[model samples]
Target: MTFSAVARSADGDSFGVAVASKFLAVGAAVPAAEAGVGALATQAFANLAYRPEGLSLMRSGIEAAATVNRLVTADAEAQTRQLGVVTASGPGATFTGEECLPWCGGVADDGYAIQGNILTGPEVVEAMQVAWLAGDPATSLARRLLAVLAAGDRAGGDRRGRQSAAVLVVRPGGGYGGTSDVEVDLRVDDDPAPVEGLERLLRLHELYFTRPDPATLLDLTGDLAAEVTERLSRLGHPGEPDAALAAWAGMENLEERLAPGRIDPVVLDLLRKA
Candidate 1:
C-alpha cells in the first residue's frame, strides 16, 4: 500500500521525502523532520510515535542507526514494522519488516535511505536512486525528492496504484512567521496525477512561500524588474502595484505574499511594469 524514499543533499543543508500510496492521508502519517535534528519516515505497519520520538532522539544526539535501533527495539511489534531515518550529520538507516509484502526492502547509506513495500520490484527503488543521483542541488530539495518519487511511479510505484502523494523538507529557519520547523510540507491527498499535482504546488512554494532575504530586493531594479514582471504576467498575474506586495517592491501572489501581512506599495510600484 505504500512506497517511499528519503534523501538529503550531500552537504547536509537540505533533506526531503517523497511517498505515495493507495491509502488515504499518507503525509499526515508517514513523514516527519526537524531542523538541526533529522528526518524519519515510518510505515509498513507504521507506529506513529516514531515520527516525534525519533526526532527527539536525534535532537538528543542519537545518530540515524542508533535512533532506529532504539525505536524498533522498544516496540513490541518490531518485526511487523518498517522505518527509515537520516541524521543531521548525514548518517542514514532503513529497515523493512520481514513480514511485509513481496518486493518489500530498502537501501541505506551515508546521507539517505530509499524504501518501499508492496512495490513492483527492485526496479522501483533503482529508479528512485537513479533519479536522486542525477539531481542538481542548484534546485530545491522539494523538486529533487519529487523527481525521485516521480521516478518510482515510472518504474511501477505502489503495487496497489496511487491515491495520495507528499513531500516534506526542513531547514534551520525556513518556516512562516519565523518559527516552528516545516520548510516545506505539501501533499496531493487524492489526485489522479499526484506527483504532478505535488510538483505544481512545489513551484508555487519555490516562487512565493520560500522567501529570499531582504538583500535580494537590492539586486532587482529597472531591467530586472521588467524581466520579473514579464515572468509574472505569463503566470496569470498582474504586473502592478497590487496590495500583495505592499511590504516590498514587487508584484506578489495574493495567497502567498499575504502571510507577513503588510503590502508594500512602493515595492509593488517598482515591481509593476518593470
Candidate 2:
C-alpha cells in the first residue's frame, strides 16, 4: 500500500522520509524524522507509536536494525508491518512482514532504506534504490528523495494506486524563520498524481526557503539599479533602492539571500516578474 525511503544527508546534518501510498494522506502516518537524529517509515499495518518510539531509540544511540527489532518485538501485529530506518551515523535497515501482501519487500544501504508493500514488483523498489545511489550527493536531500519517488511511481507504484505523496527533510535551523528543523514538509493528501504534485510543491519550497548562493549575487548599479528602484517605487516601496530591495526581500521571506552591497539575481528576477 505504500513505498517509502528514509535517509540522512551525506554530511549527516539532516535526515528525512519520503513516502507515497494508495492510502489517504500517507504523509500524516508513514513518515517521521528528527534533525541530527534519524528517520523512519512504518507501513503495511503501520504502528503509529513506532514513529516517536523509533526516533527516541535512535536518539539514545541505538542502531537502526535494533530499533526496528525493538519496535516489531513490542507490536502484536508485527507480521503485518513494513518498516525502514536510517541512523544519523550512516547505518540503515528495513523489514517486510511475512504476512504482507505479495511484492512486498525492501532494500537497505549504507545511509538509506527503501521499502514498500503491495508494490508492482521488486523493480519498483529497485528503481528507487538505484535512483538514490545515482543521485548527486551534493544536491538537496529533498530533491534526491523526490527524484527516486518519481522513478518508483513511473515504474508502476503502489499496485493499489496513487492517492497521496509526501516529502520531509530536516536540519539544524533548517526551518523557516529559524524556528524548526522541518526544512521541507509537503503533502498531497489525495491527488491523483501525488508524486508530481509533491515535486511541484518542492520547487516552491526551494524558492521560498533556500538561501541564494553568494556567487549568484547581482550588484545593483547604473541602469539595472535604476530599473530596480523604479520597479520598487511602482510597487509602493518609496525608499533608497538598496533599502527598498532589502525591505522587499524581507517581506517575501528572502532576507537571507540579501547581501549588503548586492542582491541575488534570481531574487531580482522574481521581483521584476512580480
The most accurate candidate by TM-score is 2
Candidate 2 positional error at 264, Å? 1.0
Candidate 2, which ten residues in sequence have the lowest lDDT sum? 254-263
Instruction: List the candidate 2 regions with Cα displacement exceeding 4 Å.
Output: 250-253
Error of 1 at 192 (Å): 2.4
lDDT of 2 by residue, 134-201 (tens): 99999999999999899899999899899999999999999987899889999999989999999999
TM-scores for all candidates?
0.81, 0.96
lDDT of 1: 0.77
